[model samples]
Target chain A: MAVITVRQAISDALREEMERDENVFILGEEVGVWGGTYAVTRGFYDQFGEKRVRDTPIAESAIIGAAIGAAMTGLRPVAELMTINFAFSAMDHIVNEAPKLRYMFGGQFKVPMVIRAVGGGGRQLGATHSQTPDAVFAHFPGLKVVAPGTPEDAKGLLKAAIRSDDPVLFIEHATLYQWRGEVPEGDYVVPIGKSKVQRPGDAVTVVSYSKGLQLTMQAADALAKEGINIEVVDLRSLRPLDMDPVIESFKKTNRAVIVEEGWRSYGVGAEVAARLYEEAFDYIDAPIKRVAQKEVPLPYNRTLEQMALPQVADIIKAVKEVL
Target chain B: MKKEEYLELYRQMVLIRRTEERAAELYQQGKIGGFLHLYIGQEAVSTGLVAARQPQDRMITAYRDHGVAINVGLTAKEVMSELLGKATGMSKGKGGSMHMASVEKNFWGGHAIVGAHLPIAAGLALGDQYRGGDGVTICMFGDGATNIGYFHEGLNLSKVWDLPVLWVCENNQYGMGTAVERASAVSEIRQKAEGYGIPNERIEGMDVLEVKKAAEKALAYIREGNGPYFLEIMTYRFRGHSMGDPERYRESEEVDCWQKEDPIGVLHRWIVENKKATEEELKQIIADVEQEVEEAVEFAENSPEPAPEELFADIYAEEV
Candidate 1:
């Protein structure tokens, strides 16, 4: 096992895919010379040359639109949106074209494309720069939304996303770029639409994903010492959400807690809670408690920004309430 | 152009016009449902562009794209069936009149949203370039689509990357009754290409020969590994934006003036005058097109409705 940062794992996935398929190319703003904003593709420009590692203008719509076009025809394009917040400019392309091209055309075409976008609110970059809008893309039926917490899932899910016939929206956390984990070397493909039981406990089930999964596990360690054990279910893929493990965990522990960095109203937690209620209503001991970011535009002030985000304390509190 | 080529182009234009006329009639008869945007007067643009296509080249256009679809070889039967929501439709009854795609013929799509396909066109070009292929993607849109930001972005990206693409702006006077002059800040659509450092020119789209000449020039430029080329073909949509549009935006004189330059009528006269074909031969061509459209309408009427189970299918490549 090789310990690598989430950024390196993602870059490895892209490198392996590009090396495997001649049609696979990367296009985005500063993806060439600057080697990506977070340096995820530090040496891609030199290794792949300008044609394969293309540098595009700051036109989010065109970046995604071009990828869909290329994908529809013959090539597999990996488009970087710079940030998920910038995706709003290209919403029409993502919502209308990428998802509908195959279905609307009688399944004659496939948009074999992947859009990598970064999201999170730890940075002091106000509301626009810091956002967790994975739910927005997940709402669309045709797209596969994957947000990985660990470096291993980042590498594995990305490789799977690149290989999938359908379009996949790969959402990464802005803060988790340097988060190191034991990533297995060689060909590793984590299947999409599957969740992992990060930790097993008997008292309560704590379901979370992306950065929230990291926070949930940290909170679970402290709760375990108190003899109030918590099971952690990391939902790797947000769209074709792996609810089987979540349901099994719910069956094991009647109490459930959902943690997400997105807003509370009609968010991911609401969907999971509703599903849990429908599937395991008879096994429930308490109502599902949800811990999500406060409903407001994230502030620029560091303290207020951190306050608006879902923290470890929030997860412990939600799990305690469920218990 | 060869005599056979001129005759074929003429036949295509007449067939498109006849097909659209029958489609309008079917829409009024309630046989075909949903938004119907007819390519009434601008048949020459699609005919000329498709005439200049190579086997590997791709073609995509805006909603007013029946003519282009037919020109690119989507049988009128499938297009009519798609418009009627029959199971035998081009898009398996999923896409209506607004989207008719013939996958075999390299007809990428007839996208509904204006200016959306420009970047897709660029990407198609990028794909060809990546594979070391000389094929180019011809993307068509209305004058109104020029005002869209994607148009600028797509053009710039294609130009910067030196992608193989030919951008055709069919400046059909109006976009849903708003004239290009009223809506566009830079009414001369070809001028927009200069900002992206792309070579651009304007052509009289009323003439098929002029359109064909322009298309050939642009295709050659792209085939030689040059960047994207822009062609603003000045044309007009003789009908309203869609079937329901009252067209209260223009005057009778304006419509009559454009109708006088009807592409099919103009091409028919040109073919006869240039000795490409005799008047009797042209009459036979018209009769053939009329019969073809009649048969297509019958085919669409006879085709069965899409099965209810089909509604859940085609939403994704794999089972959702």
Candidate 2:
């Protein structure tokens, strides 16, 4: 195992996939000559020729639509949206076209593509740029939505996403890119739609994913210092959500707290809470607690932005409330 | 073109005309559900274009796709079954009037979104280009699609990458209820290709032979690796945009005027004038189309509904 940033893990996964499959190529604005906006693909342009690392114009529809088309013809195109905010521009292709092509055409075509989008609220990018809209993409049935919190999960899940036949939206949190964690080397693939218990305990169950999982882990550590053993479950994939671990943990602990960076209403927290109530109602010890961003278009001011976004303290408070 | 080819083109246009006419009737009888965009006056555009392409070349089109589906060799029965939402439909009744496709036939799809498939067409061409093949993607859309951002974006990317795509705009006068002049900056849709630095031409779409000749030249240019070529075929739809269209936008006189240049009528005259086929042979072809459509409707009515389990199937290729 090697400790690396989430950025490096994702970058390595992409490089390895492209090397393994000649059909795999990258296309997006500034993906080629600009070496990627966040420097995730810094040396990829020079390593792979222009044909594989294509630079596209600032047209989200074309980038995603073309990617879907290429994927239909047996090419694995990893299209990068400068940010998840830009996904709304190509929302028709992402949600309407790519997902529906195979089923609508009665399995005549397959969109074997990956849309890599950066999301989350931080860096004071304002309301439009800063959004954790993973739930919106997760709402669709045909598209697979994966948001990995740790470096290991990022590397493994990304490789799996690229190899999957369906269209997978691999969302990377904008703020979690530099966060470092241990990642396994050599062809490691963590299957999509599986949840793992990152930190096991018996006191209370804390379920989160992506940036929220990072915050939950910190809260778990803080609670541990005070002798409160809280269990943390990382939801790797949002669409085919593996509620088995979550339900089992809830059955054991009898108390649960769901954490997410998006809004509380109709968000990931709401979905998990509803599922828990419906599946494991007998295990309930208290009303399920949810820690999420305050309902507001994330403000521009650094102080206000951090205030609106969910933090480590918020997760801890939610856990303690459930306990 | 050979005499047989001309006769074949005439047969295709008549088949499309008859199929669409039956579809309109079925829709009125409440048998066919959803929006039905008939390709009555614009049959020559797709017929000619499909006739000019090789087996390897790909084709994609907008919501007005039943004609393109038949032009690419889909049986009238299959097209009607799809329209009737039967299990034997091209898409197994999953995609209704606007989503018929055959990968083996190289017909990409019957995409419903206005300008959405333009970029997908570019991607199909990009795939061929990446593999270093001579397959050109022929994308068909309406005049209204040219006004959308996807049109410009798809066109610009095709030129920048020098992908093999022939963008064919079947400039039927109205987009839904709005006229081309009211909705678009330039009424001449092919001129928009100039902004992307792609060579383009405007052709008379009412004449199938003319459309076939122009499409051949445009496709040849792309096949030769010169890059994407734009062909804007001037045409009109004799029927309303779709079933239940009030059509308050255009006058009856205008519809009648364009009706005089009906694509099928133009082809019938051209075949006789050029001595491609006798008048008796042409009339026999029309009678044959009538029989084909009658049988198609009977086949569609007899076809079964998809099984209850089909609803949950094919949503994802890989099971969760």
Candidate 3:
């Protein structure tokens, strides 16, 4: 086992995959020259050289669209957007092209590519920079969405995503780069569409992924000291939303609280809430509490930005409501 | 070009035109659903440009791609069946007129969105470049696509990376109903390529020989690893934008003015005047195309719809 930050874990996974397959290449703005906008690909350019580690112009749509084309051929391309905020420029190429191409072509081709989008607020990069639109991507079918909450899951899930014969929207939370954890060495593969019970308890079930899981974990730890015994189910995958653990957790606890970094209305948490209603209606003891970002364009002001996002206090408040 | 080449080019152009004409007829009969944007006047562009391409080269285009599909050797049966939404269609009836594709033929596929495939084509070129192959990627689009954001982006990357990609803009004059003059500040679509420093030229698409000559020069340049080239094939669509287009965008006299230079007619006249083929030989070429289209329509009509089980299948590659 190797202890590394999420950023290094991502780099390790990419490096390992590139070494394993000559066909795999990484391309994006500053992915080569600047080591990456977030430094996730810090040493990759020197190691992989220019052909494999490409620095593209600041063109989001072309970056993704070109990746799709390359993926459709033989190459396994991992395209990094500077941030998920910029992905809006390539929404059609992402939503319209990548997700549907496989099914639409009647399985003649596979878009075996990973679009790594680093997202979340708190950096105060302003309104456009802090948007968490992973939910928008998950709304479409034929696209696998994986959001890891730990350095371990980050390395494991990314390897799985690169090897899978489908398009994967690998969501990396911007704030989680410094998060350090034990990542297993050599050929660690985490299966997609499955959730893990990070902290098991019987009082209530808490569901979250990516940076939202950070808040959930803090809240769970605080409540545990107070003898609340809240169970934290870290939803590692969003699209093939691993309902098994969720249903199992709900059935055991009979109460639930959902947390997310995106808007509250019709968001990832809302989807989870609806699913629990349909599948495990009788298991719930109270209305599921949801702690999500307030419905407003994230502001430039740091204090207002913090107010817009879900805090650890918000998760605690939501969990208390269910308890 | 050789007589054999001229005849082959003439045959495919006639076949594309007639197939689209039949498709228009079927659209009126409600046999075909969805928007049908017939490439009637633009046959010479696909027929000549694609016919000049090497087998290893990748060819992809936008929604108006039936002509390219046929030119690239995807049978009319496959194209017609796809249009009819049958199980035996090119895309198993999953991708109707807009998204038809065949991987085996090196036709990457057609994208419904304008200018989206341009970048993908660049990606395909990058794939080939990485593999150490000399294959070029031919990305075809309508004139309206030049104004799209990705068009410039895709072109810029192709130039910067020095990838072998040919950007063929079939300037059929109108984007649905809006003409190139109204939608874009620069009337000439080729001017868009200047900012990217890509080698570009404009060709009269009404002459298949001119299109073929231009494609030959561009492909030669790309094969020598000279980077991407752009060719603005000045063409027009003889039909309405779609089957139900009101087409209030341009005057009838304007349509007639371009119609006088109808690509297939002009090609036929050239073949006759240049002694490429006799009148009877050209007539036989048209007859053969009619027969081929007839068989294709029959095949499409007889082809079965996808079974109910097929509806759930192909929705994903594996267990979600």
| Model 2 chain B poorest 10 in a row by lDDT | B262-271
For A67-105, candidate 1 gives per-residue lDDT tens digits of 998898778899998999999999999988998988888
Write down the lDDT of every candidate, Cα atoms only. 0.90, 0.93, 0.90
Ranking by DockQ: 2, 1, 3
Better of 2 and 3 by DockQ: 2
DockQ of 1: 0.79
- In order, what DockQ does each candidate have? 0.79, 0.85, 0.75
lDDT of 3 at B230: 92
Best by TM-score: 2
Q: Pick the candidate with the highest lDDT.
A: 2
How do all the candidates rank in terms of TM-score, highest first? 2, 1, 3
Which stretches in model 2 have alpha-carbon errors above 4 Å? none
Best by DockQ: 2
Candidate 3: where are CA atoms >4 Å away? none
TM-score of each: 0.98, 0.99, 0.97
Candidate 3, residues A1-323: lDDT per residue as tens digits? 87999999998899999999998999999999799888888888899999999988889988998899899887899999989988899998888888888888888988899999999999888888899988989998888999999999999999999998888999999899999889887888999998999988989999999999988888888988889988899889998888889899999999999999999988999999999999999987999989899999999899999999999999888888887
lDDT of 2 by residue, B1-320 (tens): 68888889888989998998899999999999988999999998999899999999999999899988999999999999999999999899999999999998999998999999999999999999999999999999999899888999899999999999999999887888999999988888878998889999888999988988899898898899999999999999988898889889989999999989988888788888888899999999999999999999999999999989999989999988
Displacement of residue B242 (Cα, Å) in model 3 is: 1.1
For A164-276, candidate 2 gives per-residue lDDT tens digits of 99999999998899999998878989999999999999999999999999999999899999999999999999988999999999999999999999999999999999999
